[model samples]
Target: MHLKIGEVSTIVVSSPEVAKEVLQTNDLNFADRPHQLGADIMCYGSTDIATSPYGGYWKQLRKICTIELLGATRVRSFQSIREEEVSKLITYISANTGSSINLSNKVAAMTSSITSRASFGVKYKDQDAFISLMRKLVTLAEGFIIMDLFPSQKWLHIISGMKPKLEKMHKQFDMIFENIIAEVEKTGGEVETESLLSVLLNIKDHQDLGFPLTMNNIKAVILDMFVAGSETTSAVIDWTMSEILKNPRVMIKAQEEVRKVFGSKGYSDETSLEDLKYLKAVIKETLRLHPPTPLLLPRECRETCDLKGYTIPVGTKVIVNAWAIGRDPEYWSEPEKFVPERFIDHPIDYKGFNMEYIPFGAGRRSCPGISFALPSIELCLAQLLYYYNWDLPSGGIMENIQMTEALGSSSRRASNLILVPISHNHV
Candidate 1:
């Protein structure tokens, strides 16, 4: 279908064939990101992985992300942090048994802590200022700044009084990054522990490959990891809980599987989690219904391209509406229902190869945090179900579960998910 929003004519690629042509066959032509003034500033002149133009710089940064930061080995190395955070979450929920617990807030805290510790060598609990700064950054990223969509409307920043707000956020983020860099420098060439910041600092010091990694570059990378990595993982967990509560049968089935697999094993490890076929299905179903970023990041065309007989001009913003695509009746039966069983014998996955299941997006610009994010979600969900049985507070029925979404870079629960945890033994 061809649709026009303002002067731009968009070719909506809902069909798998069209989607493949746009995202894969002519992917290089659509690899660029649309120009956004606020994004340029926040991303340090669009050097960050998500906003960078399709070129050598993007390739370099993505190499760093995949090989140095979010690579399978690197993500696996953070298992201790994952275990520790999941343990804390379990402890906290157990301590609050019978009380209405805000699972969403707790899960958000868990993800924030893990991401902070892994990326910056500082956990949220250890640094109050950093935690506050992270909260501010998430808020700023979510809020609409006039300059983002309209770069030429420079006066709107002043007229709408958004300039000061943006300036304040920039200053605060700079200070936060500066403090982190300063502390890392204080270590002074010692064989310090490995962290994302430390690795970048080493690259900067060595001037690896003759490309100097500047402070702004480091800050941009850190901001990318912090904002994208933390929020999406947190939001998914919140949605998973909501969906589980909304369908008790699915919840009980998942819980039974987790417990049966890990019985008397004390704590479930990564190996144990991998065998959780049904639990994996539940997570997949949750993502299908409520992808964290409903509309994958917009792609800008670097050259004209033809998709299904429509010409998409250069510089046109291409938005792959994953939310709409996931719910399309043509692709899915009972598209609106919360049905994990749909995936039991299904071959669809979110690794971008499958056009219909691109929750993490597709092609080269797809999210690099998929490996890290999935385990974090699976482990958290597994532990929650294994340790305690949950229910809507006040003996409420499953129908009481609200599916309303809170808008931002990622869509989250409109209201925090409060559920009563009954000990599995009691159940």
Candidate 2:
């Protein structure tokens, strides 16, 4: 559907066919992201990989991300960090067993610790504050930008206090990141394994990076990885668990698969995850039902183009609602159910090739954290299922599980998920 939001032309694609046309067929035409107030303030003036406009600079950033930061070897190197963090999580949860625990808080902490340790060499002292700042930034970035829909009306931003709000928030994040860098500098590269920050700092002054990476640029990338990686993965884990808990059948089957794979092994390893097919399907189904980012970051129309016979004029902001497409009745049978079996024989995956299942998105603008995120998710999910048998608090049943969604750019459960965990081996 096409609508005129203020002065900007907007194209909202809610179906797979239209989404395919915008994301794949005429991808180049809508490759650039619409410049908005929130991204400008939070993304270091649209300099980060996720918000950067499609061009030589963005291309170079993408290359660096794929080849250096998130390369297969680099992603593999973080397994130890993930394993350590998951172990800590198990211990933490183990301590709280028999009591109704807030799994969401624990999950967020787990993801934050792993991401911080991997990205910054060590977990910083201000980790919780940093995560809080990042969440606020995400909220601002997902906010309504008066100037975005009506570019000529820049004054509205100031009038609404959005501009000042974003600027203030940006300053807070900048200071937090500045301290992070200073701490790393003080370490003098003492760490044996280089963190992503260390690697980027090493290359920041390189003459061959096509364009010199400024300090802000490095900070932008760091913020990108930290903010994007932690929250999304945490939300996925939380939602997947919620779905499984809501459907006892799925929980039983997925737990059976997990326990069977890790029987007597005590915990799940990277190798063991490959054999947990049913658990994999459960994750996929969870993603389908609840993608972290429902309305993917909006794209800009670089040029006038036709998408499924609809003429999208130049400068129109295009938004492909991945959430809607995933649940479209035409592509999915009983689109609302938490049925993992739907993927047993289905070829749809998160690799972006399958239009119907793009939880991570599709095309040149798709998320690059797949390699970095999937292992962490699987490991955490496997360990959680393998070690504990979960039940709702105070004899709460599956039907009462709060599935209400918190409204945001990335939606999570509106309330923290509290569950009772029973240790399988009576530890």
Which model scores highest in TM-score?
2
Q: Provide the lowest-lDDT 10-residue window in model 2.
A: 135-144
Worst 10 residues of 1 by lDDT: 184-193
Tell me, what's the RMSD of every candidate? 2.5, 1.3
lDDT of 2 by residue, 1-427 (tens): 7778889878788988878887898888888998877878887998999999999999988998999999999988988899999989999899988998989988888899888888888888898888788777766766677778778876887678888888988898889888877888899878646799888877886647778898899888988888667988898999999999988899899888888888867667777788989988999999998987899889998888777766778888888898998999998999998889999967888888888888888999999987788888999999899889998988988877989998877867888999999998825
In candidate 1, stretches whose alpha carbon ends up further than 4 angstroms from where it belongs are: 1-15, 124-145, 186-193
**Candidate 1, number of clashes:** 0
lDDT for model 2, please. 0.86
TM-score of each: 0.92, 0.97
lDDT agreement with native, every candidate:
0.79, 0.86
Q: Which candidate leads the pack in lDDT?
A: 2
lDDT of 2 at 416: 90
